[model samples]
Target: MNITHRVSLLCAALPLLSGCALVVNAAPASTATAAPVFEQWRETQHRGGDDLMTAGLGLEGLRASVAPVFSSPALPTADEARRRAIWSSWRGIADLTPGGGFGDRYGSVQSAPGREFSAYARIPGARHPHRVLVQIPDNFDPARRCLVATASSGSRGIYGAIPVAGSWGLAHGCAVAFTDKGAGSDYYDLDAKSGFQADGTPATHGALAFVPEAGTAAHGVAFKHAHSGDNPEADWGRHLVQAVQFGLQALDRAYPQSAPFTSANTRTLGVGVSNGGGAVLRAAEIEGDWFDAMVAGEPNVSIAGAPPLYDFVTQAALLMPCALLAIDDLPQPPVQAQARPLWTQQCAALKANGLVQGDDTDAQAQSARQQLANAGLSDGALRAGAFSTGFDLWRAIAVTYASAYGGFAAGQHPCAYTFSAVGADGKPGAATPEARASWWSEASGIPPGSGVVLVDGNAAHVADDPLRGLRCLHALGTGDSAEAKRVRAGIAKAAANKPRAGLPIVVIHGIDDGLVPSSMTSDRYVPQARAAGAQIAYWRVTNAQHFDSLLAFPDYRKRYVPLLPYMFAAMDQVWAHLEDPTRGLPQDALIETTPRADAPLQPAQLSIPVVSSR
Candidate 1:
């Protein structure tokens, strides 16, 4: 399919549902009409609505003029200090550093026979007691070597996902070390603050803080359009670095207490999805020497890499209010130079395809003019008034204009833009057209990427939209056009700053992911790692979504277990090459297995545990 056609197909797949559900498959089915596993999966999804509510999602009844925003404070209280202390203590024991080389250490948690366990770590500046969740393996081994994994986010404590999976890892003779990043879960709370401020000032805790303008085009597009201000890329990157560093300290402690110390090699790899995937990149950058390899599943490396249509919509939101309403629009050059490439390419493509015309013959152009008429603007007015002021009004007006011209608002009515055929005539489809219409808004000044479509507020929430906008603007550093360049430059700088001399890093992203785009992985991360001469693997799954590809194993627990060996084995090979550069990238390190989490863990029972140290 063509780029626009492919883009439309991808957009159609982005349905928003709050909860996640898993479906397990039966051993064998002989029935003529056995339900597809995903069909069963949907049942679980339907039942999960309640869980989503508790997780603070999908409250459709609630209305807001704007989203809530926040900022991060220093690890404020003594209680916070106490928690850090606990984390530090556990980290110290898990350290596996070698021969007094503090930087070379790693961490591991192993279960002993009889459900007893030995936890080792190396905590820096040893000071306080820690509360750690140690999983004791039923079948512990002193003879077999182990593999260790560090989680990306510490906002949530170490007890959840990693611990559960690590438990299984221990059963198979691999030890695991998880880092809480001293934030200890509660990711939502931390992100909420970092995305905004308490008193409603823009905070410096988010990705936008690193950018120059400090709330310009990027944040504006994000807040007004997407209804989400979470900058998972930078937030997760920070957490990943902290986690890996702490995890290394934990690994160092594991040695000396155990055998052959420095000579013995146990593989280490970083893995995560979405934000977690972004974390893998951060960890690879900071803890390059610690791991043999890393896997990033569907991470968006640069904000600009997201689809262009979204950006245009956000631009419209910002420009419309200021130009048409005289509210002071963001300055010119649109977004940063980095953002311009994709937008330019797409715009050119659209124009070339005749979907968007450069002249008056353009249907979109004709509709746009009609939309202007509905918004109470005449040709003289269009020529006289600024475009930024009343941009949203103009957008609404445009839809009315389109309707008056027998066209429907892009998203609201399907019939207006609908047609049969797969070529340019109807090729991009209704969704793409909607995205384009939204892009018109983003092209102006509206928040293009914000996920919140509609919001409501009470008397107390009177400042809701403004406050939310302020927080988003501040958090994303999106006060003006200069800010857009700043955001893009920051990502480039971060990518440039890192040197890659150790380990193989492979980033895999699904093209259709609604949360994070695959382009970020392919465009920014792959290039950065490749420039450093790091062994880099960048894979794009055609139609995969966020984390759906990660946790979808058929038998989940049972089937995924076997792949652990192959994954770790790849790490071992990569580590060998890292230790000895003359050896080059390992040939056998590439192992293809099921890409989805739903694949079954095959060959159920095993009496032997194969442990390899290179």
Candidate 2:
């Protein structure tokens, strides 16, 4: 039997409502199913220098600032890139510091040797391929078959979920499947005219992971998410389902004794964070009986006509700096940026632009605060968002999403915001070949980091002032232009449909998650999910914000509980309920928690409760 055959081809939408309970197994895989998108795969083995979880970095090594070095920067072996990519991803998602739970408590820190298989999968009729990687842990037992399919958070590369879903699956001896969902840091350097291949080496010709159409690129870098010419976000869920199929097939290859691995013989789960979480939810809605359960943490879900992310992010980009100052005791204020006078500039700019009317900076801040609140953001979220705002993420996200939602080509970016390597002066320049070579390992999918910068072409005279570009992005969300219509149309396609009944779902989110704020996501979607009769369990943890790695900072540790531990805990709860109905899922309630402050996190601070679901 061919495992790819039963990959859950578009199920007939029964007139029933949203997501269901434990999914009953499907029929065995066969060739007579629908046509396949990922029937072929490339395989590799990771044992000594790198293993399944953390790439053999272990708890302490993962916390290290430095990653395994490439023997030659311009020509990294695929193995070298894989190891470093895992290292970067772990640091990106989890809080590996001594104070945060690296190994002592909740994290999946042990090394697990494995075989990996990858398929450059294309959605039907789509020209670009989303990269999918599936790891079959050496300890995977066909008799106790399980698979966890995850999508990468944000626009990060395939390894983006390494520390989140990857760790959990490998630790549980499950085949872990991951996809970049058509957006990754496997960048195409337009200047170099070469793009990184699946093997992590650059190629000027042939099928690269992402190569901007010839004569259709700006003089900088072009990443898949922003310039793929296809609105990939619309198909994030389909990519993940394909990833699950890829895993089942790879498992069959790894252990032929179990000739055809199917969902009937496996306990498959979908788990993701941020955008990954959104993808998991989308899959639950679209694919019937494909997954036994799902665990989503801080999903950046898009529901057209219901407070779109681009609108909020673009608005936050312009208003958050000034407005957050109105909130008292926000952690990590933009104090250092005072040298560039950013916060003051935002306040002054807002007042001058008629966006806010105030007699003083404080009054201007108050008006901006009121504007954001009126727009649907919670004060708690604004406080947490200030941290990311300080890091200048609001502008980066606004710039990236504007291109993605509009399907804007590399050269035709909204507001002429281009991505490229920049100098200390914040001026864009052709990236050095050496820098381009290491981008796959060093940079997150989004720019404004790892040598790549988001440069506003119009900000030549006033690099400190970002009003023009931001205003353009904001208008794309709220205005009525033809280009703006394109963005809105793309956004409409991203709105999630109801999940098929009987696939148990658990959504866990931090009340203070500013990156993908709950007020804009789970808070809005969960109620709708329940109203639609989806058997979903929602847990909103207090005192926890989005990013766990930020907890490494002393001030952050004192203010917020790490959301990862709770996410892992929720995964356990959902699994337990699936294994035995009597175990019951977690109650749909807010779980209280406390920050560790200066001390090590105690079990009591977590306040995780377990009881029969009511």
lDDT of each: 0.31, 0.80
As a whole number from 0 to 100, the lDDT of residue 324 in candidate 1 is 26
**Candidate 2, residues 412-524: lDDT per residue as tens digits?**
87688888887557678877777787888878888888889887777873555547777888999888999899898888988887777767788889898888888888888
Candidate 1 residues 1-614, lDDT tens each? 00011112221233122111222233322321121111100101111222111111221211121221111222223222222322322221111112211112111233223221111111222111111222223343445544445443222334322422342345355444443322222111111223211111233363221111122221111221111222222334444433333332223333325533221254455655444455566656653244556755555344333322223223333222222222122222122244334333433333444434453223433444444444333332332222222223323322221222221122222112111112235332122222222211112111212111211112244333322321222222233444344443433432322435655675554444333334434456676667778767655433233322122223222221222222233344445555566655433122233322333233222111222444
C-alpha lDDT (0 to 100) for residue 602 of candidate 1: 31
Q: Which window of 10 residues has the lowest lDDT sum in candidate 2?
A: 12-21
What are the runs in model 1 whose C-alpha is more than 4 Å off? 1-144, 152-168, 182-184, 187-256, 259-266, 303-477, 481-499, 549-614
Off by over 4 Å in 2: 1-35, 214-217, 333-340, 423-426, 460-466
Candidate 1 lDDT at 443 equals: 22
For each of the candidates, give the backbone clash count. 125, 8
> TM-score per candidate, in order?
0.39, 0.92
